[model samples]
Target: MTDAPILIRSVEVLSDDWATLKKFTFDYRRRDGTLERQVRQTYDRGHGAVILPYDPERGTVLLVRQFRLPAYVSGHPGPLVEACAGLLDEDDPETCIRREAQEELGYRLRDTESVFHVFMSPGSVTERLMFFIARYSPDDRIGQGGGDRHEGEDIEVLEVSLEGALGMIDEGQIVDGKTIMLLQHLKLKGLMRASAHP
Candidate 1:
């Protein structure tokens, strides 16, 4: 019925090696009958995929655990168990997800499929996240992957059955929003149900 808030102006650029920040000034019209102009703010951050690589035969999925400052500050008990995800650079979402999978989990995802794109924090942060799914096989020889040293990432990869992942979500072990959304999407689509019994 009512119009969404309008962005009158915006300025954005890549800040760090792989980070993009944007400043937005916008105006909104109130319901009663008032024109309110304000300099609202949002970040057009490029968040990559949370790949839930499923093995139809094995009924397994890959998950990752890592410390997140925002989650901690928001009253989460500890670090989060999530899917392999990161920010996209100038590259497309597919490229970003592939790089993150290898860097964070020591897993190479082939035939990556785009699931959907979502806004992680639409209310405040303009972070557009792309979700993807890929198939991968276990490799015992895969070396430790905790992301690049320069990026200061210490990640631990986990191979769990889809049922186990669902349990983690139910127990609140997976606190990341993107991860939750992806899992829910898979559940709703009946993809996880075929292989994973919960």
Candidate 2:
């Protein structure tokens, strides 16, 4: 609506349960000076934050495994291995990820580096995810993190070598997008070196 390329006509709420789902009707002006009517439905589950905690000294990283209904329905038969993430209900991105790290991975992060923000699924989902990376050591654990039981989260923490994680991706084990991005980022950035472990 703010740009001249599009004009919003109407927005209708389709569902208001767990998250808000809406149908948007608009007119899009093409580069050829033609107007086209478009209708799209977007699922709004709010934005979220995700963090990958890595130990450069050990050349290892922390991850979690949990059941995802969407992935299950999409033909994955088991729990998904992913980086720590949580929705930003009423907290900022850093605050939300810190809480998620404690609840999901049991690590008290000291310094966190903001990586980037992305729209994981911009086609239909109206959720923006903030990405981060933090250094973690063995001594950062404060509790047995398996997620909040009241939230029906039964997570399993994983500590694997950086190389092993990349192999998992090739083996179709770690298929989550955010997890893949963080792992690849760590590798591409050379944040951890082969000599780091020795």
Clashing pairs in 1: none
Model 2: per-residue Cα lDDT over 92-167, one tens digit each = 9999999999999988998999999999999999999999999999999998899999999999999888998998
When superposed on Cα atoms, how far off is each prediction in RMSD? Answer: 4.1, 1.8
lDDT for each candidate structure: 0.74, 0.94
Instruction: Please report how far candidate 1 places residue 181 from its true position, in Å.
Output: 1.5
Candidate number of the best TM-score: 2
Per-residue lDDT tens digits for candidate 1, residues 6-100, read 54655555353544555555566777767776765555555555677776567778888888887788888677898888777687888888888
Candidate 2 residue pairs in clash (backbone atoms < 3 Å): none
- C-alpha lDDT of residue 37 in model 2: 96
User: What TM-score number comes out for model 1?
Assistant: 0.81
Kindly give the stretch of ten consecutive residues in candidate 2 with the minimal lDDT sum. Answer: 189-198
Error of 1 at 151 (Å): 0.9
TM-score of candidate 2 on Cα atoms, chains taken together: 0.96
